[model samples]
Target chain A: MKEIRWHGRGGQGGFTAARLLGMAASLSPGYYVQAFPSFGPERRGAPVLGFTRIDTKPIHDHSKVYSCDYVVVLDESLLAVVDVFEGLKADGIMLINSARGGEAFTASGRQVYTIDATGIALAVLGQPVTSTPMFGAFVGATGLVDLPAALTAVDMTLPADSRAKNREVVEWAYNELRRKINA
Target chain B: MSNEAWEGRRAFISANDAVSYAVRLCRPEVIAAYPITPQTSVVEKLSEFIAGGGMDCQFINVESEHSAMAAVMGAAMMGCRTFTASSSQGLMYMCEMLHYVSGSRFPVVMMNANRTLAAPWNIYGDHRDSLAMRDAGWLQVYVENAQEALDTVLQAYRVAEDAAVRTPAMVCLDGFVLTHTYEIVNIPGQREVDAFLPPYAPGENVLDLANPRSLCISVAPEWQTEFRCQQQAAMEAAKGAIARADGDFAAAFGRRWGGMVEEYRCEDADYVLLGMGSVMGTTRLVVDKLRAEGLKAGLMKIRFFRPFPREEIAALGRRVKGIGVIDRDVSFGNAGALYTEAKAALYSAGGASPHTVNFIAGLSGRDITKEHIETMYRKVMNAAAGGAEREIQFAGLRWEEW
Candidate 1:
């Protein structure tokens, strides 16, 4: 099973991105996926968690993810408030949506990758929400789902008026991270 | 996951949304339900469907949960297929009407998102909401996932509207855990659901002017005993109706939840852990893990609580050496309600071979982690091997005192 935890504030569309990941992964025949939020005291700016579990077999565990394969932070500001690395596996990768360099957040024993998801979101979606852009970066960082599947998920999840822009955001982050990782 | 797509109607949706799709397919003439957290999404989705003209049903915007049940009961009284839903405090608000619907022999089906009751003021998943209504004269069915939640809604209509069992049924989904959680669900075609459920044949149980019948009348002590006996008989008859509905549903939909209780890997098992709803899903994984480690572990999932599966429990007791009952709701002063009922069912099991331990956890939506389930299995293993173990143990407790 591949578990990814999304860290973002309330109203950031964190859960939407989590669900899109599940939808993208489950597009194939062999994959089974589940996405759920840590729902509590939900407000505009309170810290929240959205989790996605993708696996070849059906997921039977209903509990919160304690060990994650990847942790995607939609808001870099959440780094100071929440311990995003609490349940991160030793070899797990941490994908952050920040302008800071990856080395700034990278601990000695951790793999930390940074992407200007908000910058991409601002440029592409004309919005400050990093969920779509970070979603792309997640796929780029993990390669959990194919590029076409990720774009298809954006199209399936977004409204008709915004589908094109959101798809662009996903492709931008995905290709950017792919380019960086290859370099 | 099966390789076959069932014509590829698969979609990713929450269990609450799945219930909305199932309710739409059932073609209920009247849909009435008040909004409540977790459950509010189901109500919203249903309203969206009705607004979009996807369903030809009267959507009742009731003032309160009490009126929600009353509206459905009135519609059902007129021989109209009806549906309603509630959860937590909302379900408690409909307590009076719960008995009224069941006592009047109205086959009103409801979807309840199982949530923790408020005193500490929580809005999370727990079985306490449904277990508290154990004697409400309604048939309670708990589901494991979005697919079961959808399939059971159709089967609930079938079982409830059965001529033998004219009992109201409540299909429960664990709040937030199952309700808000999104998963890829195999949505069956509406034509298939319609074919399987057919239509709700009223069969003379209606308040019609031409029929000239008195309904919802009070029965005096002279005949109240017989009325109660008939209700009890209907409850007993529901056991078979539930099984038959599951069997027929399996034939039609290619999925079966083992009727009342699904025993997973029970054959040749020494220790079996029993639970209900989503917790059982987690427990099933733990059971498999234990089996892989050479421990004879099994999972007994209680699907139906109202028509308690005692015969199956007794049969399981006769086979296993130790049985662990994991209940998400406790009966307050006593042990977990599920554990208490399982023990009551195991009263006449000849010799005291299978030792019982109750693990009360996941109250108020606390995470019943894999480790917690494994701990329950370990305790069951210990008790089965004649090792000392507490009769009732709480899993994942912050402070382990008594």
Candidate 2:
């Protein structure tokens, strides 16, 4: 089982990102996935969290994700406001939507990958909804799901008018992050 | 029923959306509801369906939950299939009409998003809302996930509108837990649902001008007891109707929920954890983990809380050494409702009863984790070994040291 936790604000599309990730993973024949938000009464800019769990077998544990293999932060500002790495596994990976390099973050014995997802979102989507691009960086950081599958999920979730640019941004993030990791 | 082919489709959607889709397939003639948290999406999606010409139904926008129930009752009495949904405060507001709907034997199917009642003002998932009105003479079923939420609504109408069991039914899903969670679900086609659940024939309860019959008239004290007795008999008849509906649904669609209670990994287990709603999903995982560790642990998920499944509880209790009842709602001064009911069921079985413990957890939407479930199972095992300390235990209460 691979569990991932997402951190963002109320209007930042954290919930959408989690659902999209689950939908993408579930495209595989044998994968079982779940996506849910930590629901609360909140307005825009308030801290929000969402979770996704993917597995080879049917997933039964419905409780909140305490220990997760991946943590995706949609807003780098949430790093100081909340404990983004609270329950991350020892060998887990953290993907941040930031312009800063991975060396800026100190996560002992864990890999940290930083990408300028907001920039890509602004360039491609004409708005700063970083969920799609962040998902792209996720696919790039961990080759857990196919890039084509992730793009297909993006197409399914977004409007027809926005699909072309959203797909372009996702593909750009995936290739850009993969190049950075290899470098 | 139309001879349309069964063309079920799969979708990744929330439980709320699933309920909306199910209700659409059932094709209720009338839908009246006031929006409430968690439950708001069910009606919201239904409204979208109506607006988009996906559903042909009268969607009544009522002023309050009370009015919502009253409107549905009127529509249902006129021999039209009626539907509504509410949660927490909205349910409490509609409490008065609930009894009238049941007493008149109007088969109004309602989707209740089970939420905690408020004093400190919380909007999280709990069974307090629906369970509080358990004695309103309505058939109640709690679902674990989105697919069940969809399938059960289809089954609920069948059980509710059965001539032998003319009663209202509340299909419950945990407010935020199941209502907001997204998962893959197989939605059966309208043709299959229509074939399984034929149109609602208001048979004897129709309020027509041609008949001019008096309903719910003033009854003398002597006959009131008989009226109540007949209602009780109808409820008793519902047990069979529910089972048959589940069987027929399984034959039509490819899924069945074991009718009243779902026993998981309990064939050779000595200790079983029992609960209802979404929490049971977590308990099942813990049971599997304990089984892997060689502990004789299992789970019994109560589906129909109104029927109580007394016979199934007693039968399982006879084999297990101990059973833990994990309830998300408290009965205040008494034990949790499920724990008390299970104990009474075992006591009436005319034999030695299993050692039972009550673990009250997840009130006001607090998270009940795997650790809490594991602790409850361990307590049951210890009690089975005669290490029992108390009858009722609060699973995740925080206390300051004295």
lDDT agreement of model 1 with the native: 0.89
Per-residue lDDT over A47-143 for candidate 1, one digit per residue giving the tens place of the 0 to 100 score: 9899999999988888888999899999989988999898899999999998987899866368998999989989977789889999999999888
Clash totals, every prediction: 0, 0
Q: What is the lDDT of residue B89 in candidate 1?
A: 99
Give the Cα-based TM-score of candidate 2 against the true structure: 0.97
**Model 1: CA > 4 A from native:** B1-8, B351-353
lDDT of 2 by residue, B49-72 (tens): 888777889999999999999999
Model 2: CA > 4 A from native: B1-7, B400-402
Candidate 2 residue B8 C-alpha distance from true site, Å: 2.0
Worst 10 residues of 1 chain B by lDDT: B1-10
lDDT of 1 by residue, B203-230 (tens): 8889889779977779899999999899
> RMSD per prediction, one decimal?
2.5, 2.3
